[model samples]
Target chain A: MDIFDGIATGFATAATAQNLLYVFIGVLIGTVIGVLPGLGPSATIALLLPLTYTLEPATAVIMLAGIYYGSMYGGTITSVLLRLPGEAASVVTSIDGYEMARQGRAGAALGISAVGSFIGGMVAVVGLMLLAPTLADIAVGVGPPEFVALAVLGLLLVTYLGTRHPFKSLAMAGIGLLLATVGQDPITGATRFTFGQLSLIDGFDFVAIAMGLFGVGEILHAIEQDQAVKALTSKVRNIWPTRQDFRDSAAPIARGSVLGFLIGVLPGGGGVVSSLASYGAEKKLSRNGRHEFGKGAIEGVAGPETANNASSTSAFVPLLTLGLPSNVVLALIFGALTIQGITPGPTLIDDHPDIFWGVIASMVIGNVILLILNVPLVGVFVQLLRVRPGILGAFALLITMAGVYSINNDLNDMWVVLGFGVLGWLMKKTGFEPGPLVLAFVLGPILEGSFRQSMLLSDGSLGIFVQRPVAGVVFGLIAVFLVWSTVMALRGRLTSGAEMIEHAAADEAELEALRSPAAPEQDRADADGGGDARATTRTTTRSRHEEED
Target chain B: MSQHAYRFGALAILALGAAAALGAVQLGLGGLSAPGSGLWPFITALVIIFCGLVLIVEDTPDDYETWTRRSGKVGIAFVALGVFIPVLQLLGIILAAFLLLTFWIRFLSREPWRLTLVLAVAGSVGLYLVFGQFLEVPFPVGIIGRQTGLEFGL
Candidate 1:
């Protein structure tokens, strides 16, 4: 395991001023975009992808990878303060963070999320440094059925990630999967849902759809609710967590890091699930039945934020090792690699040690830079929120259009972005998620091509999916989750009437608990006042605000 | 009066998607007699349509009172998007895109128009430099062509 040799060699390449500078800049930009409401890493990468075209493939890969993790951490800032989630992965932060805000613990919540993210990320990176070779060795053995089942499970996990209501989350994911099918067919190389337009030939450009859904859609949502969680609240106090806060978060952070790393190593899972799952696990592990969950549980914020960063870092393993991409950002990074004519797989280590190790070294450097930048630069990012949504949205729209056009010198791609932008906005409001859509889009071709290739190898038998024991196990896990989700859904309908009031209140209350202090509460209270004016209100209100839907 | 028109809308969309997928498969890909590229397209569409149907049929939504409270901007945005497509060649990709984005930002939001215009222009310029000049990929160029790359000091 020449770990020292690998690290030393990686340093020689990654330490170059140009590569280092790009990695730092990429991490910085990624964090800034992640802090903002709209642009998460996928859009951030798409926006930056064109700029990197001139750089060495290794440098480009390193920078893009830096952005992915940087954004993962950056999202926590908004999730903690604004009670407005910056990215889908950061949504869990708002669950406890906003609650902590309402409880006047926003500072502690923010501090915990940051510290936890740092710990989780560092731990995961170290894990990757130690474990990637072995994992990659195993990953090389996975075949097509494994990927297909993994994709299905990945999308399903994301679909069920909704905190307010599981059903809505599943539906959103289903819609995302459907959207993925909008592009060219992998097996036949024929375009679907493109309506015969030349632009449609390639299927939906991921850039277009990503920018539309996560970027533009978020902007629209932000515009509609331009008011911040703290718009009317007092400035937060106690920026540092107390010793007690550390005591509470210590276990959860460690648990989250390990849990997140494991989940992230899986085919479909990534930071979002790891973070969310960690939070739930943390809550369950707590002895207090701590009402702090929606009311400012520092552990809640810290655990999930850490898990998110850790998972983002671990995602690189499969991507670099097996040529597997669980999410869109990795897919884009893969796209960058393919553009440069380099294939990412187990042999990559031997073929391009400079690139692989350089990327690894750069990841460490990028995380260090982010930890330094995330807190001190908090003011600058928050100020971005002050940039009128109109201005930001307009600029984002323009950048998307021109960027797509300039890339291919094609008007068709621009039109595709605009079209997806419209769909993105609608999906946002309608409870459809853009995450699964992206996964589906990126993997559809890979899945189909691999399936056909495997069939040809096996002479068209169903045995291909179960040929390898490891692949069989992975598919079996997916089957369990599918059945579990199905049972949960059916049970939900059966028990619906009993928990109606309780179910509805969880979301509203979580919003209330996560509030900065004065704003959302007054508005929410006023909205709910009409219903409460008559009967004994506290009990009904309490029931309405259950922790889970 | 629940605002969950999404439940019904989802089903309708699923049907349409499935039909399209089915139709595309029949159209075949590059050649009529061969396996054709269209086969995969149709299958993908079928996958989506099937999943959509499963989701819609499985989950019965609540009422629509909440849906009405929304500003109703989604439909308007859709209309604007439909119009933005053909308008591209007329104004050139850059100019048309700039206009569409600026209009969307200005009208869709409550902020001042100047900021929106500035954002649109700067964003377009950044894209021009990054994608066009820096990356050396080209766009339709509109009135300026690749010559615009020089003006940006690229």
Candidate 2:
């Protein structure tokens, strides 16, 4: 369909009462889940996936997509008021946002975040509208060799860029790939690891594993943390920012929208990465960034928040057009789409334009709903912190069990959920992230299937990978990335023990900035004198250590 | 985390890789031209083993969280859920979930008894209303209902 025709159709599809209701429910649940300390977009979506089984395909996707970006707006509230990130993407926001809250400018920080998120989301929607169709056109002619290249590159990028310990992440991904081989071989009908169980013939349930790993696992892990949270309540009087605040944030928001849009198009480059990169760029690029970064800088709050929201919107481009999920959240949406018997790829736009454009259009409306909800109901969402984490954990566990069981009406799925939940908890305590693992699990079939196709087509010649131009370019990119990562890893290892200790100390102080309201003052003072050096160190540490969504 | 933690994780992965590799070999690894069912799995197993060895040789980073006294609660929660699944068949979802929720809220979470009772009842009934009734999830009617001749949201 043409762009204008798609837009009109999208509006027609999304404007119905049923679609609007789903959108409202999606954003509302997303906002609530985001406001709560433990649940993130991934877990929430995984928990709700089975429930979407009965809905229309377009409506289901529109709602799930709404939750993904709406959470971006909801996440800023906790960051600003409580100094606790509602999700990983909002971690950077807590640095300057909480500082602003302490100075009685909480409203200004939140207001700028809301305004910037709206602008960023809208801009990204426009980008997606224009870019995805063209990308899909280009992808239509791509063969299995390119598919192998793309999947391999994507897996490598996520492991290399998503975590600090590349070896561990790679191992997790390897495990995920192995897990994907459990049911039956795609080429041959022989089972690889079913172990004689009838249910094993179908392989493990994706919904069950996801809900277990992210939902049950997170709740189990969350219960172990310090549950005390304090929201700055007295100083939230004015909801609008001062004119100077707007002036300071305007440039950052624009820059963040552009930066986030570009980054989100790349695999493994959204959520935390987008926000952290934006924060780092704003710190280096903004005029007064050096002085204002850790001390109630509206620019600092505006940049990361705007970037994360924009990245969330634009991350849809890969999933809709290429059938490659750029992050874990998109992976869940991909699962949801598969459950509805719809394959998302280059043909998706042609096959299901209503779903493709309806989802995109719903995001435009969802962003508007988020803006309206955040501006007026910020305090109400803040009050959700009072609901207590323990209570939330119990209910989440119940829902997870019920939801997973309902998927196939089979009790074996519950076993899978509990097994993965424990494994997820254990993984968390050991500093192993499940993001790469889950993404690899979703991509494994595609990678393996394409690889076999390429091999068969070429009569076992390995030259097939580099024979195609697109595949050649992708492999070349992968090689460059590998070399760069090795160099960085070597450099990291070569640092003196004392330097490593110093970096670790600086990292602790940054963590302290998130945990304690009083700590930012010391952090600000440190930032004021030689903060750039420490800031660089902190950015490197976070990029390596922080969890990618 | 301690060096011991890193060693343990690496060893576990290495063992898993070895087992999977054995399974793949038994399944028959075919040539490159006509791959067998085991070809992809064997390759993945090798990658896992390689990653494990790399991690074993590397210096341990002090980034992981260690278990505290409070971590027992996670174990307790896991065991309870494991038991709850079977009990769900015996007592049905409503009664089984009620009991589980009560135990979790009252004991595991250490909330007030009054609050625990209220939340457990509300949570169980609410789940039935949503998943069992509204969504028609077809939850099992357990021994309790079978004997009592009462079907609760089946």
Candidate 3:
């Protein structure tokens, strides 16, 4: 019948006690991981991927969806309380959220974010329920060439949103694609890059690499740096938002939801770009005299938080419609779908309407669950770091290792985790973002496959890309992005060079400030962590030193 | 000669990846077959290698002494992983995991035995329930469990 009636059917399937329980569990577990520093959706989903084997396809996807969106709900807690981001997507949250905490408006900010995120998530789920099947129906007519063009466009959009570092992002993505290639040829029955380990025969398990790169890698970096974030006392002066705060945040939340959902529909688009774009949007809409954007602004928290949630929910669009996933996390869910013998494309609704509709309804359920679970537990989460970082770190490593081993029961998988963990640790130290690398690796193989198949299908004629209307539009977008990124990169390089020279000229003044007693506290603690008094002194000293420098 | 040679290092890796990919292509012409799986996997490698070459050629280096200092923590993490491999097969999956968790939590995170033991046991049992019983995937039984598989109905 109608889309709403379809969603009603979805609600009936998703409302069953068994399915509701799964959503609750998924959201709770996801929120916990999201609250913890470095425990992100990709790693958590990867670690839990094995357990989905027995679940009904619909049940498993609903649960996975719960976890994916649930993380967005919990991410703001750490960002606001400890000034530590639980995931890269939440980095923007810390800018205003912690500032609000510093200004004694932590409770209000948290309230706004929780409610804002809920609204955003609900809006996107509605989009998914309405749009996914319609899009899948439309995609039915597309050929290999169209898919390849769409994939190229996805890569370009992801790379473009990758900001001034599109080259690095593209490189990481390219490398990831190559890594995806390291398995046996399914059709030709030839070993491509196994280098002879039997486990390598199936190629690398996505779970293993996700664990190695996202989970184990993050733990290694967290431990290696040994930086303990300070927890904020719940000095939530205001629990409810003021009328002014609500008025200011309403339009931004609505805008973020629309922007985030649209952006997330594109392949490889997720947390980073959504957050950044939301921040940019908020900044652009600022009042004339309000230049206080970077130091801490409420719009910054409200916009990004809403955007991240909406985007997270909308990510299901491609996975559900095209039978293709844009990121590693969705890829794992796709693998789960494959195990259940249901391909994820245009035929999903036609063949299995229950599966498609049930998941969309479950998102609505999961968002409600997350709101219930996260708000009350915010107090517990805010103070989590009060427990020794060392103790938490040990448990994190153990769980991560155990999870990694469970993935394939292969020691080599654990070794891979260690290798990437070390690399991640190094990258963190070196100011390189590892998120793009992992994202790259996930999308790499699929893009290559799509591109090559399109070429082969048209007998190596580049004209095939433009021949299809959809494909042409997608490629046109890619061309624009490529051109824009090139110009931006050149400008960025020049500006950075200029900035570096300016810094070099001011080096002596910075050195004097560093030696000064009033230097910033984190830098002072960086030298030594003798006691509380010492730490406070260090922070104070560093701030003053920073001022002089 | 630059302070950070990572660009060169990255380039070297890229060069190596490219050379390896060329060798990979010699084995197949990339899927003329059903799903065309070969086309994507094979060509992706070539792109990565090319990008690696670009990264190397356009490399930028930075001072990196801080990374070298955390060798102790890194060493322990790797060693813990090495210990886990042989243990899962010899010891029971639950016992092996418990032991692995204990060492990692107790030593790596440097927590007390009380906390580590509880976490280790909880983790193993949770894992057994999910991956083994619920999923119905047989975990690798230890020598002891294997010898007594049917007896315990494992």
DockQ of each candidate relative to the true complex: 0.28, 0.65, 0.36
Mind sharing the TM-score for model 2?
0.91
Candidate 2 structure quality by residue, lDDT tens digits, A118-145: 9999999999999998999998988999
lDDT tens digits, residues A144-209, model 1?
666666656655544443222344444444444445556566655445667767756655555666
TM-score of each: 0.77, 0.91, 0.82
A1-549: candidate 3 lDDT, tens digit per residue:
468788888999899998999999888877776666545666567556656765788998888878777777776776676555555466566667877887888887888888888999999998988898788888787687777776666554544343223444456666666676677764456776777788788777665666566556555655554434453554765656788888878888999999888877777666655766787778767755243555456777888889888988888899888866765567667767765777778788878878889998998889887777666667776665454544555555655665555555655666777777676556544434444455555555555556666776777777878877888888887788667756765665422211221222223542342233432222211000001011122223324434544
Candidate 3 chain A worst ten-residue window by lDDT? A524-533
Local lDDT at A325 for model 2: 86
For model 1, the docking class works out as acceptable
Worst ten in a row by lDDT for model 3 chain B: B59-68
| TM-score of chain A, predicted model 3, versus the true chain A, to 2 decimals | 0.82
Count steric clashes of candidate 3: 10
The candidate 2 chain A region of ten consecutive residues with least summed lDDT is A524-533
Q: Which of 2 and 3 is ahead in DockQ?
A: 2
Candidate 3 local lDDT, residue A28: 82
> RMSD per prediction, one decimal?
7.6, 5.8, 6.8
Q: Residue A226, candidate 1: how far off, in angstroms?
A: 4.9
